[model samples]
Target: MRRVLHVTDCYSTGVGRAVDTIVGLSPEHEHHLLWAGEDDPAGKGFASTTALPGSSLARLRAVRAAVRATGADIVHAHSSRAGVYARAVPAGAPVVYQPHAYKLLDPRLPRAARTAVAAVERALGGRTDRVVVLSEQEARLAARLSPGAGRTVLPNVPSLASPGVRAPQPDGPRRRRVVMSGRVSPQKDPGWLAETAERLRERDPAVEVRWLGSADDPELTARLERAGVSVSGWLPADALVAELTAAGVYLHSAAYEGFPISVLDAAWCDAPVLAREIPAFAGTGLLTVADPAAAADRVLEVLAGGAVRERALQGARDLLREMNPQVQRQRLAEIYA
Candidate 1:
């Protein structure tokens, strides 16, 4: 079995879920994780996991040291921060950098900050043997970074050993709640979700909107809570799946993404998705609109139950047919080969 070393500086949300999908898809390969984050190591089936150092220079050194210690054949780094560490290392293993979402694409970052990040990414781009991306939009961004490295798009699909996605129960009662998953952060755009929630509440105070993850920003959580959106802080897989499967609709409000795993989770659980019109959702066939007001209106129309809701549900299921995990595995085999 090929010994693959997985490195990530982010373990809380998107990057964490992306890694889960990758490692779970190829269990035949031995996987080792080296992470530097507040959360304890949570590997799906890692042979081992090591903690990276606290400082930036130390973390870079630790990445080099871990490569030697593990004798890894391939180094897969998730997120831009870990990409820096992995690409900068002199280790001889092939390096694949997967930016869950480019920091340059984040709407909240300052212009100067983005420019600096872009410069750093371009500097290290040649060191990456292959840059794995999730969508065409992200692929274009990676190409702009540097022309030297090869680019591949591996769409995020639900991994194995997950809570079985309940088949779409057309005759059964669907829960009234509209839900979203992923940590509350600027990228997830809790502010916009809060605005949408308020609009939802104004129309129908009884509307139940729920968030299914922990808070990265307490202030954002407060905004959501004040808007009458209930936050279910970090449910386990089964419970989270149960929530998604029963919800009236899944809402994806992320301002930027490389195809969030949470959206795939909703699709897997047969929850109709009403998502923002970001490039990530571009050709995915989810019921999408350009603005929060339109999204809020769409959610209400969907909840009322009719052709609109039925079409959304059907579209979500059709999308799922294309996102089959086994097919994803076949493609992944090509990447790892």
Candidate 2:
């Protein structure tokens, strides 16, 4: 069996789930994970190490050492940071790099920083055997960043193993709640969430909103709380799933994304999803809104119970089927090959 080393600096987000799925499903190949971060759920089995730190130089050195120690035949680097580090190291192993999302596309960054990151990505493209992206938008961005780089589109699939119990639609009067999961950072547009919650509460004081993730910014956390939105800071998977299942609707307001796993989870849980009209979510069949007000309206429509709600739920199911794990497994095997 070919020994494949998976290297990543981020092991807490959707990227972590992708890594876990790859290693868990592909038993034909020996997998080793060299990762950085505490509480990395993906580093549970097989040969693994957390020697790499987040710093560029440190991660490069650590990855090189891991490659030498493991004698890895193929090296798969995940996330932009790890992708840069792993590609920088000329370890003679075939390298596959997957940038969960391009750093250059982040609008929060300064123009100069974005340009510099793009230049770095272009320079490193030659070192990568293949560049894997999760969406068509990302594939297009990758091509622009590196003109002739070998590329593959491997869409993310929801993990079926931890499918949460679907909460039955309420037959009687019940508390209405809208839920969202992910880190409360600029990327997620916490400001928009806070504003949306305030608008939603104004329309219906009884309506409640909850964010099931850790707060990266204290100011944003306070804003959300002040807006009458409950922020559950990073619950365990089971607990988060339970919270999601109980919710009447799922809302997503990310400024950007490679592909959101939480949206997939919400769809699998049968919660009607109303997400922002972002390129990443285009053609996913989920109902998309332009702004927070539109999102709130969509959620209210789902809660009201009618043909709209039924259609939304059906759309969620269709998306879940489209993102089947078996199809992902086959595509992954080809990429690995």
Candidate 3:
């Protein structure tokens, strides 16, 4: 069997979904997942599973044990910390580092901390066989980080439950709803989103901003509630898809990102987008704004539901067709093989 060990800090719902797609496509490969913080939600679907604690010393021991136990032919890691440990794994084994996004990308991180992480990657990244980034901008950043590190871009793409059928749209009164999905933290900028939603409601009281995310901040839920924005804990996979399809507008206020999966999810659901001006969100015809007032204006324009909304929705669907996950998975298989 072709043995592969995949490592990640948390096997996120998205990461879980991606690994499921890979395994479903290639059954010939033996895949074992190791992660920090939590058990593998994705591994339940797999034929074999292993969960290990992710502490530095524990990781070293567990990885050494997993390497021996699984005889991992390829060690593929899915986050920054995992990448660091994967690189630290003994040489001669093929090591693949997929840092969904580098730690340095978060604007809230102290400059010294970001610099420290960057320096670490620069030093140890050369040891890895390859690095996979999720977007063109990220690819450029990774190239700059380690000159000799082999790298490739595997843009974020969504896979429908089935290959041939278009995803079903959920039936609902549009209600001028605007949705955002991600971890409710500073990186996602939920505070600004709450502020923007209040402004949007002032322009159109019918407008509702619903954030589907894990509330990382206890106070975030309180603040958003004060602004009349609906907050949901992580939804089940099917419910998430339904929620995305039902919304009229999708909002993204992230401070920084690699290639956001939430934006791609909204596109798949055919939700028109209004995003903060970010390089990764380019080409989608999204109303990109620099400030909260401008973002609210863009939201109001789309909620008006005339030529602008139709044009943006059609444009988003066109982009989604091109970025379907089958196209990306094919590219990923080729890169990894």
User: How many clashes does each candidate structure show, in the order listed?
Assistant: 0, 0, 0
- What's each prediction's TM-score? 0.93, 0.92, 0.91
Ranking by lDDT: 1, 2, 3
Estimate, for each residue in 171-198, the C-alpha lDDT of model 2 and write its tens digit: 4443489888888877888878888888
TM-score, candidate number 2: 0.92
Name the TM-score of candidate 3: 0.91
lDDT of 3 by residue, 156-195 (tens): 6764453543575668656568898987776678888988
Off by over 4 Å in 1: 38-43, 159-172
Q: What is the C-alpha lDDT of each candidate?
A: 0.82, 0.79, 0.74
lDDT winner between candidates 1 and 3: 1
Error of 2 at 30 (Å): 1.2
Clash pairs (backbone) in predicted model 2: none
Best of the candidates, TM-score: 1
Model number with the top lDDT: 1
Question: Residue 204's C-alpha lDDT in candidate 1?
Answer: 80
lDDT of 1 by residue, 88-175 (tens): 8665688988888888878778999989999999999889888988888899999999668888888777642254534434446777
